[model samples]
Target chain A: MKIEKTEHFLNFCCEMGRHLVQSGAEIYRVEDSITRLMHAYGYTDIEVFAIPSCIILNIMHEDHNYTKSIRIRSSAIALDKLDKLNNLCRRVCRETPDIDTCFAQLREITSAPLYSELVSYLAHGFVAVFFTLFWGGTALDAVIAFASGLAVKFANTTLGRMNTNIFFTNVCSSMLMASVPLALQYLGLNIHIDMIIIGAIMLLVPGIAITNVMRDMIAGDFLTAMSKLTEVLIISLALAIGIALPMGAARMFLGVM
Target chain B: MLRFLPCLYAFIACASFCYIFQVRKPRFIFLCSLNGAISWLVYLLTDFLPVEAARYFLATIAVSALAEILARALKAPATIFLVIGIIPLVPGGGLYYTMDYLISGDFAMFTAKGLQTAAAAGAIAAGASMVTSLVRMLTWRKQAHAQS
Candidate 1:
């Protein structure tokens, strides 16, 4: 009886984590790991948002029936649906997300509460920093700029399913950063294009597809990973061109030469 | 500090820019702030660090893993944190500079620098993926063993 209960819980955790990703949770990889832990617990029906991050799973050793190793393995990413609703209210004062309604919807979709959005932010920051030193400072500037823009595109596409205004996001940011060299010259901040490396470190923020591909690959879902990665490459290419187009145009028009 | 303002603001702008994509509800402002801080911190560290070449790889791993952990703890998705945090670290400008170099027919230096930057990026991914994938693979293998 205990084993069955445990199995059910494990399955539930993995399922919810999976759903979170499918529903476009930003932190799919984190969910992937949490679900894996859930699978180990033998809890086939693990509900994340319903409970807290810590869930106890007991391992039954056959040699001694009474003496079972009570392992308290914990899973993270507890959304606390109520908190999300409140947070939603604070953030969007005009239109609050109805907690009761959101919970009902969750029953159909099977996801965590909403706290995991914090984790997604960490992932974005990490990637942004990592890309900063790829080239000298000059090259780094442009890349950072693009990653910042791309982060939005990926975020919108994954979670909100909104258009994200990919085109202008890049144009505006790049246009701002493009003038780094010349603009600084006027203010006695005569820095080289290399100085912009820190500026461009955010350009190729590969959040959506990277997380998706990694999760799919880990789950033994090779097809999804491949497709997701291909999509990443395409998005990446588009992102590359976005900045390039504006920079190219500005130079020609301004006669930077 | 003032010199870094443009990059900083650009990073913030792009980091918050995701609200337009994810929910369009403005409910994600906190989410946006969190992402912005993480990504900005990483980018800023990379920018200020004295060790230019080798440290980039380490910084990438540090940032990515942090995002993963933060995601796990926050009950949100890793994408939220990672996406925002990654804003400050992309190398879009490098490709531009390299292309500009080529466009100007300064093939030798520009091409070489471009390749170097790409390689640096590869190094970052390779390091992070190695650890994350290995742990994941091992965790998976152990589970498969248990099931079988």
Candidate 2:
């Protein structure tokens, strides 16, 4: 490969790694995918390293080393996009497609549309309702949880658009989650406050973070694992504080514990 | 019948999560939701276990194994199934109650609930990692034999 083409390929590999991490892939998967792509392009001297928030790629060709690094600021789990990207990588490895063509395909996968906003809101509501019922909440509790879930989703998207940090977003949304049911109880509604709060809180839980942390640890990426574990703890603390603030206020002012 | 209501609720919740996470394909969504149901059912059946965390551990082992199999059969990543499937077993309720106890000034109960939540989370991580490592080992050995 020519020097210019090698540089483009290196950039392409770095972009792929960035997308994988942004799609919430395991650290090892990102590293392995980039390494395999480089080897598929007939490069023997390439190194790839990825963590939760960054990827570094280096390639040596013709006594010249090219290095590219990308810093990822945020990520959300989108399994459909992840599956498409995984397939694209496998196809590129098998066919050794031109770098430009590969870039085009990557663009398509990344640009794919997610479910509509209405669908997402409904999904959040249903998740809360069903989980409330799953935890022994009554019919009234499920109804209230469904509404609270929609409110939480609205808070999440609005805060997300404002580019607020995740800790603040979670804290605000969780406060909403707790206060909604407390407000209902104040209005003389027969609802299970704990059940409704748990349901809405499920939308903000760190289940995926826990799963990814374990996988990263098993992959021997102790640094990534520790960072992600810290993320889990921080999110959990934020959630607990968010809930405690509202409950404490209710108990102190209204004696509504 | 009535006893399985929680499992049914778990199924619907997981299916909804599939949309939130953008699982997209109908087949995978249904399978992932079913896995959630299975996870809760396993948890319920293992009520005989002495420790509550043990039930979560067993449920997670089942989820991880099923996710590995589904990934192989569907040619998709195990995370597609594993993340959604394990949702039902996450200790969201435990975390909430722990905080509730803390707020109510019940230090003894708060401590107990806090420890229980931590143990549950630890058990889940251990279960998932153990199964995943075993699968990785088996695949690695198989590839080595193929090359030899």
Candidate 3:
């Protein structure tokens, strides 16, 4: 391949890898997909390394080397995009499509529309309501959880828009999670405060992070595993502190504890 | 019939998560939610286990195994299913009670609840990793044989 073409291919590979990571693909999957893509293009001497927040791709062609690294600042669990990306990678590997065609498809996948915000809000509410009922919460408790869940989702989106860090975002959402139920309880309504809080807290739990941490460990990507494990611990601590604050305040002022 | 209410709730909860995680396909959403219901059902049926962690381990295994099978059949990544399917067993309640005990200044109950919560989380991780490793080993050998 010409030097110019090689550079473009290298850039495409890096972007693909970064997208995979940003869509919550495991580290090993990102590395494997990039390596396979390069191999399909007849580039044998290529190395791809990916962690949760960064990806590095190096390729040796002719007498020169091309390297690119992208730093990913945030990721969300978008399985729909992940599946589309995985299929695109497999198709490209099998057919050896032209670089331009491949780039177009990648753009299409990334730019695809997601569920609207109203649907997302309803999802959050339903998750909380069902989980509250699953844990034996009464109908009243589920009703409270539905409202709190909506509030938590709103807080998360608003804080996220301000570019606030995840730790603070979680703390604020969890604080909202606690105070809503506590406030309701103090209002002389008979509700299972514990169940309502747990239901709302589920919206903020690091379920994806926890699952990825173990999978990374199994894939022998200990560095990525440790980073994600640290994330899980920090989020858990933030949640505890968030919940503690409201409860402590309630006990001190309202004598509710 | 009444005993299976929690499983139904788990099903709906996982379906909602499918939306939250942007799993767009209707078929995929149903399969993912079915896996969640199966995991919770397994947990409920294993009430005979002496330790709570053991029950959680069983449930996690069920989820991981089903997720692997679904990934193979659908050609999608197993992580999509595994993450949502395991949510019902994530010990959110334990974390709440642990915090509650701590806030109330009951150190004894706090310690016990905290350890139990840790044990549940650890068991979940162990169960998932074990199944994933097993699948990887089997597939690696099959690929090697084919190449040879």
Candidate 4:
């Protein structure tokens, strides 16, 4: 089954755009890459509009125009995927690979394996412990943070695999994280509980949302910025509520440790 | 030498998270972590400054500028580093304290910590946006010149 050349080109371009957006590339970059890719494929009149979750493209060829609107709902931060997609676009522009091969390459990039679960858990744990050290915590504090980090990471990964709602996941993992130090305190380990809790929760902070919202706005993508801003607010609110739940329960049950 | 220890830990923290983010290339992981370390060092060095907010703003400015240059040189998005690199300066401590005070019914402390966290967040945003806007302007000028 062979598709028309223009249709295939449009399909490829849209697929690339969708993947770029889904992988958390900035909106302006997505639009710019798509436009550049189309121009490289000999399309003179092309228009691309990308928001955080949707990409609309119009390509004009031989007196007929083709339009495609791609809707992408969920996005996660994957810098490796973004880099790969970026490189693919550059290569496509330079070499003009055939559409089938290009699509195959795109699939490969999209399906690239992520870091193993064990690596992710270890990385999160180490990051938490290091953050505790950065904040002048003692070795014991770092160790407690390490444990909490592993717990939270395990919880997060499990919830993510289960496809649970993000807000609920945030609340559950954060409650689990914040309660670690409290439990240690209840055990009378005499540690700086605040540092351990803060370090563990740092792994759950909305750093990506915070940075990307500003980046999108700086790149003049206000719609994406607003959406991302809402996302950040929701995540941060979830974090606050999540941490507060266990803390409130601890105070109520244990009478202010 | 003593002060550098925290910076080294900041680098490790950034590298660890970058790994979790699946940044595979060793070169990229090193660059991102180095940027994070430099920015943390900047924050630490500026601790003697009068205004605490300035610490975050200045460090973020340094990080964003470095990320821009690195992005151009490496041909990767500035964010691959910027997001993780800026983490060490984020007011995670302030945020925790804010929530802690609120939950403990200490309105005075909560207000203070809340304001400080908000200020730090604002500073981070301002600094990154300022640097990005400047870089965009410079590149726009270069493109215009090249076109002409």
Candidate 5:
């Protein structure tokens, strides 16, 4: 391959890997996918290193070495988008499509529309209600939880659109999760305020992040494991602070004691 | 009917998470939710067990093993299912009570609840890590066999 063509091919390779990492693919998976793509494209020697935040790779082509580094902003888990990218990687390994065609396919996977906001809101509400029931809450508690879910969902979506930092977003959503039911309880409702808040708070609990940290550690990616561990701790701290702020205010202002 | 509510709620919770995660394939959502429901059922069924934390460990092991199998069969990441499926087993109630006790300044109750919460979380992590490590061992053996 010409030097120019090799550089372009390296660019394509890094782009795909970058998307995978940015979209929350595991570190090992990102490295595996990139190496597979390069090997499928007939590059005999390739080395890839990917973390949650970035990807760096080197490939040998026609006695020349081409290296590329891609920096990507971390994103939330989107299984559909991740699946699409994985499928594209599989296709490249099998079909060996041209660079232009591969680029077009990658673009399609990344740009595909996510589930609608309404769907997300409804899902959040359902999660809150069902979790309320599962935790032995009464119907009234479920109702309160459902409303809290909607409030948290609204906060997350609008705040996300405004490009607020994720810590702020987590804190805001958790505040709503904590305060909505408490506020309603203050309005003379006979509900298990604690149950409702627990259910709503479960939606914000970083389950995926916790699980990923374990998987990363088990896979021997200690750096990624530690980074994700920090993320989980920070999210939990944010939840604690978010909930504590409102409850403390209520205790003083309304004399809820 | 009351006894079945937990499983029903588990299904709804998992299915809703499927939507929240933007799972594109309808079939995947069903299978993944079923995984969640099954794990919850396991948890409920073993309630009669003497050790409370052991039940959570058993439930999480079931979830992780099933997730590994399904991920292989469907060609998707196991985390998609495992994360959502384990929600029912998480120590949310314990966490809530821990916070409540702390807020009320009941240090004894707070300490008890906090320890219980930690035990539950630890049980879950132990179960999941065990299964995942087992899966890794199996794969490594297979690779070594192929190479040999």
Candidate 6:
């Protein structure tokens, strides 16, 4: 029964993901997060997933990505949100005793903080360039690091739209990052360029902006994504300065190796 | 054998990834590798081009035009070729030098290399952009003439 529910939820999430992508929403972490939520609740069957899963999902998917100001709704409604989850779980469970499964499940649902996700892509790129030059890591590490960064950035930008209750993507990205130094070391490569490349690629989602700018220019959103991209470019320039200036200062003060 | 292959492969991968995002053409792969190899050669040259300024941006234009033509012929991404080719030119080392100097408190080396790198990147980007637009203009003119 549990297996059946899990299967249904997975199917639902996949369809929902495709639909979101089609509707032009950047639904990155939604699927993974939703699946983790289902796994937590121990609801592994289709009939059990019917209304409640859809309700939670529908609410989560309502807004994202065009950069509209987020509505600052009341925190008092958070319980109402949790109640929706509890009520849905109960309805789906349909008289299955041992509320232990439900409560235990709640504890397992995970989620990520936003600021980290926002910085991931740029970090990846910076590290990529860094590692290749100084530490002497090779191509494989660069690719893996950048891919992980992309996934993380996508998650960060889209996570809010995909139910904040689940946080799997953030953890996945962190784990990927933690593995970078180890990967570089395993190959017996110089650690400087090797690690920094992976780290830099963690943040290099440049192609996204490049493509978005072209599209916006062609599509005529002129003021929005382009202006936004300009703002992003300034921030990136700032971040680069932050990294470069401090190092530059130190070099002038100290002697080179 | 496999040592240089990593650099080559990384360039290819980066180019290919950009292509997937439709930033440029896939034939850009050959152009970038070809350009990178040339830049590598030029870096080895030291006589005609100064390692200081001319090396990074000059090699970039040669590769950009080459990749642009390859892109036109193959009907693929232009940026792909430029990006892949320029991979070899990325001042990964300069970045570290600046970082290391900063960490060790060596301001002089930091300032010197930092300005050089920022200038190199700017020069490369500027040159590549100009070459790409020029290529487009030439291509369009030829097409227009042919139509008549």
How does model 5 score on DockQ? 0.70
DockQ per candidate: 0.15, 0.86, 0.85, 0.76, 0.70, 0.04
B1-148 per-residue lDDT for model 6 (tens digits):
6435444445444433333222322343345556656655544454475455576666666766776776567544344445445555555455545555655668998899788866766556555656755765787799899979
Question: lDDT per model, in order?
Answer: 0.46, 0.92, 0.92, 0.89, 0.83, 0.43
Instruction: Report the error of model 4 at residue B92, Å.
Output: 0.9
Predicted candidate 3 versus true structure: per-residue lDDT over A133-251, tens digit per residue: 99999999999999989988998999999999878998999998888888988988989888998888888888767767888998999999999999999999999999999999998
Best by DockQ: 2
Please give the RMSD of candidate 4 to the true structure: 1.5
For A28-76, candidate 4 gives per-residue lDDT tens digits of 8899999989989899998899998788999989999999898897777
Error of 4 at B35 (Å): 0.7
- All candidates: TM-score: 0.48, 0.98, 0.98, 0.96, 0.94, 0.44
Q: Write the per-residue lDDT of candidate 2 for residues A1-257, one digit (tens) a residue.
A: 45699999988998888888888778888888889899999999888888888888889999999998889997888999999989999999999989999999999999999999999999999999999999999999999999989988999999999999878988898988888899889888888899999988889999878977988899899999999999898899989988899999998998786
Clashing pairs in 4: none
Candidate 6 chain A lowest-lDDT run of ten: A65-74
Candidate 5, residue B109: Cα displacement in angstroms equals 2.2
lDDT of 6 by residue, A104-169 (tens): 444342121122433435543533443343235555555555554454456544654665422243
lDDT of 5 by residue, A168-255 (tens): 8889998888888778767777788777878888888886777677778888899999988888878877877787778878777886
List candidate 6 stretches off by more than 4 Å. A1-190, A193-257, B1-48, B99-105, B143-148
lDDT of each residue in B1-148, candidate 5, tens digit only = 6797789888888899888887879888888888889888998899889877899899999999999999999888777778778888877778777777777789999998888877877788878888988998999899999979
